[model samples]
Target: MIVLGVDPGSRVTGFGLVEKRGNRMACVHAGIIRPEKAACFQEKLHLLFRSLVAIIQEFQPSEMAIEDIFYAKNVKSALKLGHARGALLIAAAHCGVGIFEYTPLEIKKSVVGYGRGTKEQVQYMMKMILGIRGDLHLDATDALAAAVCHLNTASFRAAAHHAGGYAK
Candidate 1:
């Protein structure tokens, strides 16, 4: 299965496409999406939405795994994040992709074996897991981690569905 993972932000959004290959995983693509600094909030949202729509159309991923909502100390920052996330969600749905949400805790635990793992740890582990080398932006690494988390959790999610359980 191909999973498109997203780490949403107001200034910079990260995205990664991961495909399961037998017992392994490979990164099909990964990068950050950032509108120009001069962009207004609405323009930024529009650009993000259009960019992601193009990405989804190009990659045609089977599923999209995005970070779930979380509390932020700054209200303005949180609101902008929510707006960005909304754009991302609309893009995926528009392209007919199944959407899944994972909490930061779940994503960290799945990727690093620690719910509160540090970002540096998550970055190091992503390289090891994907057998990739070179530095990646924290947002990009987190996006990749979200994809890996989905791959690791897929089996459980499937079993839960069969057992009449639910996923959130």
Candidate 2:
């Protein structure tokens, strides 16, 4: 299965792609989308939407995993993040990709084995899990973590179903 994960931000949106074969996961691509700094906010959003649409068309992922909104200290910042996320979600929907949302805590726990793991920890574990090499941007790593989390959760659910409906 090919999965695309997105970590949305107003200034820089991160994206990662992974492919799952049997029990192994491989990183296909990872990068960030940065809109022009001088562009208006609405234009930035439009750019985000267009970039994501192109990405979806190019990758043709079977599923898209995104990080859900969390409480933010600043209302304006949170709203901007929501706008970015909305654009990504719309692009995925337009491409007919199955959308999966996960919380930051869930992503961290799935990748790093702790809900409160630091970004460094999550990045390290992502590299270890995906056999990634060299330095990776935090946002891209987080996006990859979201994809890995969804894969793990989906596999667990399937296993439980095969095991005669085991409980969570």
Quote each prediction's TM-score: 0.93, 0.96
Instruction: Write the residue-wise lDDT of candidate 1 on 95-126 in tens digits.
Output: 99999999999999999999999989998998
Q: Put down candidate 2 lDDT per residue, 10-110, tens digits, no spaces.
A: 99988999899999998999988999999999999999899988988898889999999998999999999999999889989988999999999999989
After TM-score superposition, what is the CA distance of residue 113 in candidate 2 from its true location, in Å?
0.8
Per-candidate alpha-carbon RMSD to the true structure: 2.0, 1.1
What pairs collide in candidate 1? none
User: Distance from true position, residue 126, model 1, in Å?
Assistant: 0.8
Highest-scoring model, TM-score: 2
True lDDT of residue 27, candidate 2: 91
Q: Model 2 RMSD to the real structure?
A: 1.1
The local distance difference test score of model 1 is 0.91
Q: How many pairs collide in each candidate, listed in order?
A: 0, 0
| Poorest stretch of ten by lDDT in candidate 1 | 151-160
